[model samples]
Target: MFSFFESQRLLFYYLGFLAFALAVLTKGIAGLFFGPVILIYALINKKLIGLLKNPHTYISFLGMAVLVLGYYFGREALNPGYLEIVSFNELGGRFEENLGSKKFGYWYHLEGFKNYRFAPWLLLALLALPLAYYSKDDKLRKLTTLSTLAVLVHFFVISSSSTKQPWYDLPMYPFLAMLASIPLWILYSALQKVNLYSFALSGKIIAFLLLVVVFRAPYQEVWDATYKPSEPPWNYETMGSEHFLFNVLYGKDNLDKAKVLHLGNNDHLRFYKKVLAQKGIEVELIEPENLQSGDVIVTCQAEIQSLLNENYRLELLNDSSVYRKYRILSANRKSPIDHR
Candidate 1:
């Protein structure tokens, strides 16, 4: 039983489930890369350790795991596409092309760009700092430096051409560890050089500062935003999709004034539309046969949700959850709302 849990295949399979949860809860990218990238890194590192005779092989594995997991959960994500880098909204819409072309989405229309916030800058800073701080103790300073630079260069170059996301930056975490390991590692090369007992003050101070920095404002936001719903119509606190959609579809003065569509698939679409009807919002649930040419679609991240191409454009939207309402749905916003 213990071995099964520890087995790479089993571990990755479980983590892949987590990725699915993540994909549904927030963005699909987390679930997409979480297991795959970590498994790949473990395999690569394990191979390297096997080629050499070192007493610290197990210790190195532990350290690498810690580093990778830390970066995976702690550091900023390198998400792909404009949604990670911008804000977009879809009011009472399931899907719509040219509805708001500038809105951040996965597919590129003839439209140019939309919101470009500080996410990119923040991600770069995250990759450079603490990793370097932690790696300061390593002995392979130069090798680590060159190697890290190479990795960073590749990451930046590859990402530069394509769209960007917070998770996309994850590929660079390993490299940053390489750079960060240089300083402290040289000092701790052996117990005799300075001894682990020495420089207790600096370690505590750095650790405290790191804890503060790493667990600062973003951590709070992540905790809050992670568990809480980001928008209204969908309770950030509860399963609000049904309530939200119903209200949007038939909530007195809302349906008539709004153009909406469920981008991917929500089996509950009919259920929610029924709720809307009960609330006096008259709406027509649709299939491809019923689709209008210029219908507006309200899209959210729907993991593995299937839909007919003729029914909706399959537009994916990110979250711009304002208050209790899920305001906008970018292609990247996996809100667990689409239960197709």
Candidate 2:
């Protein structure tokens, strides 16, 4: 980012600084590396002290420091244990627990590289780096080399972490795209040299082909969206089936006046509560054993048999391979005998 904006207008330099601040705010520690990344770029360009002496650099750092420190203090003030968790428990053993093991950290990142089912694309993108670094074009070589270096740094940092997820590599996509385009440039140059057509016409064709290759996945996705049935709203981002469950309810009943309850974690319950809150409908999450008279509970098929023995009425609402939605009737507290 700094490289792109360094030689631009004065406004662009400040804009670059703002971009760095925003990155840190949104991405946390991942974005913090931008500070060192830019500094290294300055050193590579033989402007190390020149960058440090620049007032904009200091302003950017000051802004980010204030934002981060203020957030820390605010969180600590709100919850006394927040500081302790942030300092020790937040990422300490948490990643290992979530990831299951640290041995596959590098493999997990490699697997994530083919997120869109295009493994070869990433391999080709990597191959472009050396070519870009050694190119005859001074501007292209320098910019590509810098971008590739930044991506490598990001990759190593993220891969070293105990936790991993596919979208964690999003920051490297732009550099990958730039690197991927090297082959097209080479193809274009070869075509122009062959004199098959005017240089201008050949260049236009190559540009169009490059764009087509770049946008192929989007084109395929658009086609799928046009013809495919509406898919279940199972989002990995939230790691929940709340949206699908809600939509199932939406089809058969009015949520505004419905009695709703969920049997799950606080995070999942919060999703249900937020959706039902404005309508003055309170959704309660109850223990399976504490099944009371007139209690409505949401649970899956696996627990239905156990609930049945306790005299809870079950109505199947929606069924999926992974999760089955059911409306559990209240337990008959008057009699200990099973109704089913």
Candidate 3:
């Protein structure tokens, strides 16, 4: 949308403003990247002077401010203490989560790029940086520079945080794809000049095959090994050791806006909290000793027998080898606590 505005599309400028506002509503601080992306785009286009004078640019900033305040106040209205919880969870809680985990902070992405996971796709995109830097075409050079700079800016900002996750970088994917396509088309055009049909077709086929080998094969292998027929919604046991129950509770269960009594450690608890929130359901983590009647227990496989012995009618919700989800059918049903 910012690109559209840069190209003098007035309608898209407003649309982009609305789009970024919606993004802010959905993802909070994550959606604020458009401000920097637009600044970088204007800088690359040498229109920073005009940028300062543009009424539409100021409107964009106004729209963003409105969105930020509206989202903050709206959450406060909804829960009163929501922002306090958000601050603690987003900052202190997240920092604690990263204490011992060694999954690269913000630089994990660089490792993926360097490892050639996507090979020519990644390599081609990277090659565009230098090509764009040295290109004679003004428009192409500015756009590519904007893409590169936007990605770098996003990376630098996100990396400053102690916590990093794969999904956090989604905003950067489009720019990376844009960068990769530059060299890709350049190579195709070069091949076209060398051999209009024969070599071009062969090169295309080879490139396609290489992508299949480098990118698709590993993903397909993992999918085939984990996917299950009975569990139509989710692949069993593939969602981490602690997430199996979480997956079934949020994925397969049909209870409308159901509340979940989670009997487990706090590991991956936030993910389930978010998922349940989307479903308009509440999730509470409770101790095993505090178990009550009619309270469904979501726990690892080892706890199933103990739950059964406590006279809770066990309805197996998930039965994967790694983890399980079970429901306690009757609060009134009484039997031996250790019949198992």
Candidate 4:
């Protein structure tokens, strides 16, 4: 499994840096998703399918997969900057985020902090437990159970964000998917030797999972958010090639510019600005305190008024909060804050 680990090393570093930076800056452990990300890193490097064939190859492949997949998945698209726009504009709603993380790590936060949005992640992790414990293959069982618990805890904790930002859970998805895949692969391998009854059952179960993965609802927001280049098409500058968030939102191009205040890694807002600048529109990256009326200030629900001057009006943009209050609010300069 040295090869697997070899591949995941970069991923680990990339995610590690991201988690550390986010934790320090956000004053929260929204970075907890990194643990699952690491677990997935271990699995991918080891090469799940290959390791299953020969337990000896397990460790190496696990390492490799984690590295490979982690590198691939650890893009800026998964960060809070893109996630906020993407979550509201596309993908699942804020119901799944753990608010507790807003104040601290998910577990350390208050009660009922985590809400909806557990798309079989917890179930799959839990299911893998018994399989790993009972597996005929000792090596696989240990890895499976270990990985399963990692993902389960990751999901349970990260989901508690009082402020549910989509990217907060980004680190866990790859690990969750990989962890779930292992048990099925093991089950199939085992059933191949057993009678057709169990084999058929395994087949059915695997097929069902395939359906869940494949047929899940599309992120219409993203598809609809796609737009082509023009005299900057619309007026504002949109950085970043291919709207990761936009794609998840409209499922196509909406072709509009957001005067966003981005607070993320590598200055995510700044990252997008470079690209949009190419298109002739320089996007502004401001902090909440820099928030101004009439300007579309994009930030977490909690941070909205943190930068607000109270002179402008709050319009509904998106609401992914624990209380499910105002998620994405717009401060309109047209009307008085008190009047509206």
| TM-score per candidate | 0.31, 0.67, 0.60, 0.34
For 33-122, candidate 1 gives per-residue lDDT tens digits of 333333334344464343234344345445545644544454335544434222232211212233322334342210111123233233
What global local distance difference test value does model 3 have?
0.64
Top candidate (TM-score): 2
TM-score of 3: 0.60
Report the poorest 10 consecutive residues by lDDT, candidate 2: 253-262
RMSD of 2: 5.8
Tens digits of per-residue lDDT, candidate 4, 133-182, equal: 77777666656655555556666654543454445555555655666666
Clashing pairs in 3: 125-180
Look at candidate 2 and tell me the lDDT of residue 60.
63
Model 1 misplaced regions, further than 4 Å: 1-143, 156-170, 173-206, 231-243, 246-260, 263-284, 287-340
Q: Candidate 3, residues 180-298: lDDT per residue as tens digits?
A: 87876565555445544555576666656555655577577578777932332343223333354355464654433223343344557667676766767666656554556566555
Candidate no. 4 TM-score = 0.34
The regions of model 3 sitting more than 4 angstroms off are 87-106, 116-120, 134-136, 193-340
- Across residues 1-340, which tens digit of lDDT does each residue of candidate 2 receive? 5444446465667677667667655765566654666667777878788767878778866876787778878888998888677555335644444554435646576566767534657766776767766678877776776677777777776676777666667787777777777766766666545534455576567656766876798688789889873444543223324544465346533333223333444576466667765556555554455555444444443434454545666666545543344555555456554323
Q: Could you tell me which residue pairs clash in candidate 2? A: none
TM-score order, best first, reads: 2, 3, 4, 1
